[model samples]
Target: MRSSTLRRHLGLKHEFQYRQWCKANDFTSMIPKDVKIRKNAAEAAAASQTIIDDHAVPLPRKERVIPYSDELFQQAAIEWLIETDQPISALEHPRFREMIGIAACATNGVKIPNCKATRQSIIALFKKNLYDLWTQFAVSNFCCYMVLSAY
Candidate 1:
């Protein structure tokens, strides 16, 4: 049967719902549980203190998370705007310019190695540092800010 017809018959609006319906029909509706959580619980109950496994191979060490500072990020943002020729005033909307500024600064080479900024991270950083960005960049004596205020 066509997907639309099946959807209409089954009243499924999404693919996950269809998969759930298939699981129900196939008698495998129960979702799989994590093996590690169960093992951890069993070990906790069995021993007074847990011991580390020396025989187990150690996982690779992750890179240290560097804390963000406003000064460094703002400098990067200004430099990025200058280098990329994406001056804040040229953008149509104030909010979009601010968001781009945040992305440019927050994903600086020192902070995010290779600077592959995700939209979610940019948005989060922008929201977290909204006041700083506004006071430092938006309401400042910079030419761009003066032009933005005029609009």
Candidate 2:
């Protein structure tokens, strides 16, 4: 197959990496100069079976290794959670609002600029009506449950 056709078929990226890899290896000279590209009776019979044997070698199949990255996905869920609520809902109280704030801070390690400023921001952000954002964040733990289940 034409290289361009195969590249397009595979959605092959023309990135620096593949170019570097191609430059590092000489496919044409992989066999001795005397050897023909196509298999010939003389070449096949006299040649070490190494080349053909290498072709028969199968790559190790990648085992499914689902990772549990609670920290990584916690932020990812924010987008989905935002979809479920309006910014108005983002301000209103949901379930377990206080617990929600502490958990959100703990899970994401939410920190204030400094402890004094953090206290001030928490006081401001967790006012009665707006505290619901924390509950929404705690419910985010359910997404963590999802990553756990895959393993």
- TM-scores, all candidates, are 0.23, 0.18
Report lDDT (Cα) of residue 103, candidate 1.
Answer: 65
Predict model 2's lDDT versus the native: 0.56
Stretches of candidate 2 exceeding 4 Å from the true structure: 1-46, 51-63, 79-151
What lDDT tens digits, residue by residue, belong to model 2 across residues 11-56? 3444445445546884322222213434575676777545576567
Question: Which run of 10 residues does model 1 get worst, by summed lDDT?
Answer: 27-36
Model 1 misplaced stretches (Cα beyond 4 Å)? 1-64, 90-151
lDDT of 2 at 123: 86
Cα lDDT tens digits, model 1, 1-151, are 4754654544434546755776778743222222355677788888966556776788796666556688975787678779989867645567866766676565433344344566777887888798787777754668786788899
What lDDT score is found at residue 36 in candidate 2? Answer: 44
Name the 10 consecutive residues with the lowest summed lDDT in model 2: 27-36
RMSD of each: 22.6, 23.9
Q: Pick the candidate with the highest TM-score.
A: 1
